[model samples]
Target: MPASIIEVPVVDPPLAAIGTSDGDEAARIQARLIELGFWVSGADGDYGLTTRQAVMAFQKYMGFNDPDGKVDEPTAAALTNMDLRPVSRANSGTLVEIDKGKQLLYFVIDGKTEWVLNASTGNGQSYTEPDQNTPGEIISGVSLTPSGLHNVNRERPEGWWEGDLGEIYRPKYFVGGVAVHGSNSIPNYPASHGCVRVSVPAMDWIWESGIMPMDSPVWVHDGA
Candidate 1:
């Protein structure tokens, strides 16, 4: 018998230009493409060749005369109209807040709150005698979390911590090493080398939530 034909259904792409591939939108597109028998290696919100091929295959299946690897109107429409299953909304919209004084990480989602186990802050003790009484005393808590608008600039799977100090594990977002990431252990006080410490679950939630847009606002504080 000849090789069986795996009947693949058609998928209409979204009507809207499917906004920039970031956060939830990217994840959704990736999932849908994979479901339609398209090879999407990973869902990182990047519209690469794999995603394009998937779109093209979907278009062909949908009976479109021009099944080019482009998410044109018809292709988008097919994907949008398909009877695709919905993904779970776990880690939908969560914001990360790092408190230096309290040494805590907060995940704000849907107006609710989820706190990480423990976190440490920068070293507040130990200082050299300022040039033999040149200055009275160096102030503590001088290095506050640089307050400003920032975002998840970069994300690394492994091999990030080679010449790093302190206790921080998977460092995902690197805003000058002041990232919101996972750690081996978190203390209930300032102890980090200079990075925000969060739990693994919390880190994963941040990644999945897709709320932290590029150049998002990040507010760091001493204490309320």
Candidate 2:
């Protein structure tokens, strides 16, 4: 070893990318997400699908370019600072606002956005599928998420219901056949058959919270 040579210690960057393993770091992240109104099934140490969805929701709400659900140094810092909370577009009353542009859902209460979740809406693409009524014939329609004010006219309280396109869990129909419902796959981008798709756990929480009840106002629009 040279006398003038000096040693430097390398340090690992701050990250909590949880997988199957359970740890306190995962639990802390989950708790913070829940506190910030990102719906996780529980604050357990396991970073499962629910926690991942919640992290994704938080990232999307914060307008991150890459919301990959990975808790990196930037995400950890943002989580520590609690000033960034989502706001509602509406002026008054409680309602559900679906921002198609952002692919997010805002649960507004008293004009304040209390909860934010990642959502997938219509992809604005034409599709052809077998008609349920007549399997031999094909049906065609554009996958469009209707914009404007609507109300919860119908809903399926529990279990999965077979829809024209696919199975929707606990659907809360607002306009025609379109509803904000639980889905198995809620990608960061808009991809749905004319429905608002949130994580299955999120949909369960929404039902339990009663945020959007029967006749509850639902406003769907592109981002500002």
Residues 87-157, candidate 1: write the lDDT tens digits. 11113344555555444444444433332223455555543333222346432233334544456677664
- Looking at model 1, which ten-residue stretch has the lowest summed lDDT? 84-93
| Best-fitting candidate, scored by lDDT | 2
Residue 74 C-alpha lDDT in model 1: 59
Task: Give lDDT: candidate 2, residue 116.
Answer: 80
Candidate 2: worst-modelled 10 consecutive residues by lDDT = 2-11
User: Model-by-model lDDT, in order?
Assistant: 0.49, 0.80
Model 1, runs deviating above 4 Å: 1-94, 110-117, 125-144, 208-214
lDDT at 3, model 2: 23
Query: Which parts of model 2 are misplaced by more than 4 Å?
Result: 1-21
Number of backbone clashes in candidate 1: 17
Per-residue lDDT of 60-156 in model 2, one digit per residue for the tens? 8778898887787677766766544556476577888898878888887776667788899999999999866555888799999999999999999
